[model samples]
Target: MSGEGNEPQAIRKLQPGKLVIASHNAGKVREIAALLEGRGLDVISAGDLDLPEPEETGTTFVMNAELKARAAADLSGLPALADDSGLCVDALGGDPGIFSARWGGENKDFNHAMGLVEDKLAAQPDAPRDAHFVCALALAWPDGHVEWFEGRVDGTLVWPPRGTKGHGYDPVFLPIGYDITFGEMDEPAKNEISHRGDAFRQMVAAVF
Candidate 1:
């Protein structure tokens, strides 16, 4: 992590050493790692360290991200990064904002969760099918100091889904100004415009 001169005084600069990613989701971990590549940091996941996943009691994405980052930093005695991201549909009033993972149940079966989303929206097909993906990122030091960033990408929901590249609601999400769904796009293309990508860039500006 190279600190830029314009970094805020309140934000602690990371020095690109061993940092823990507070997550068990392989897709998320992989995305984060890809975003952080070439930053010269030795990154490791909390799952790799056998750290227990903490219950996400926060009502908001930022709060949940902070909770996970704090837990990992405290447990590993190292700097940590955490991300809480989900899909929010206007028709559903953000039904699965924080419970995106939970909607998949203990097995984390996203296919089942996607079916539920489709079923819930079937009753009102003409209703506003607009949606968005939101990502909140938190970086924490061992001493509990934290920096937060949030990003979102507006889009519309596609019925029956499409593609198979990305995870979560990617197959059903067609981002604004794009012809294909997120799942249909390549990794680099998706990363360039995703909610997580935006949040990660903000974090890099603040502390990297």
Candidate 2:
């Protein structure tokens, strides 16, 4: 099928060939690789390559994802997939959107990150404390072609991290109309409506 500008779709369908997942985070790699399993593709994490991680300096998720994917594709001479995701809080004026991981300063401590959220929302007199997780997925080819997909889940923030199953801000994020935080939900249940799932599904539609 023709893609934008009548360019042939950049990605070939998932097959037996190797595809690199450009992420050092094991959680992100597992989630994405699971989605691609049994679809006739061999999904490998960049970590498996022991390659140096590219710095994520882009301000937006798309740019960051593209940067990572292209860097991996160039390095490995294979198609690469990368994702950049974060929690965006409305009350904080969408703060911690791009810097969600480093919000607590340079410690990279998740507990510290979660603590910052509580502190930021403690004094909100009338704000909804609404938030969402945004995920952007990018696929890059060694030939310089690229494709992107995005997904999000609307939710609200709560005090006190609730569950230990999930990482990042999952413990405080309650999806719309749900009583439990993402941390409280099982992995299968959460993936069904997760931002990563949506974006990955989009990429699958494009390729497979």
Candidate 3:
């Protein structure tokens, strides 16, 4: 909802203090905390504070991330970080863009979601079936300053899930120029090329 700045903006160092990660998902929280830890930042998930899960009504990833970050910053009285991510398929016209999590309904059935994707691509023999995962990270300061960064990895959707290393759509999505799926890749390798990694790098550049 603001102008894009190519040059990195100033981001305050989080002082050897705790920063709340505004997310209910433990996996996401762990990943973010690990990333921030590399910068000498003490990170804690909102769940640790028993904060209520804010409804993600925003239409876009950036909006939703900002909404969560703002809420956490206001409630915790400290800087907050949040991320919104999802898989977007070009063949299906981005059917799962914002609804990637609950694509199978409120239960968040990954099996059902994967099945649906396979079914949609089954009939389209000539379909591109190209897909990518988009991750957007937002940081909100208590004083009302906010910054956002985004990253994506282009890939294609494959039938049948593969490895179990990563979570949520990782098994079926194969990044370009790679033979193995993301879930099959080692943790360090995946972290090096992942969308989250890119966004986190941008965030780090802004801060340190």
TM-scores of the candidates are 0.95, 0.90, 0.91
Instruction: Compose the digit string of candidate 1's lDDT tens values, residues 9-117.
Output: 7677789789899999888898899999999899999999999999999999998999999999999999999999999988898877899988999998888888888
- Root-mean-square deviation per candidate: 2.9, 2.4, 2.1
Give per-residue CA lDDT, model 2, range 78-144, as digits (tens). 9898888999999898878878877866656778898887787887768888899999988888987
lDDT of each: 0.88, 0.82, 0.83
Candidate 1: clashing pairs of residues: 1-16, 2-208
TM-score of 2: 0.90
Highest-TM-score candidate: 1
Positional deviation of residue 62's Cα in model 3 after best superposition, in angstroms = 0.7
Name the regions of candidate 1 deviating beyond 4 angstroms.
Answer: 1-7
Candidates sorted on lDDT, descending:
1, 3, 2
RMSD of 2: 2.4
| Per-residue accuracy of model 3 over 91-168 as CA lDDT, tens digit each | 888878878887867877777888888888887889997999999988888988888888889999887898987777
Number of the predicted model whose lDDT against the real structure is largest: 1
Among all windows of ten consecutive residues in candidate 2, which has the lowest summed lDDT?
Answer: 1-10
- 1 against 2, candidate with superior TM-score: 1
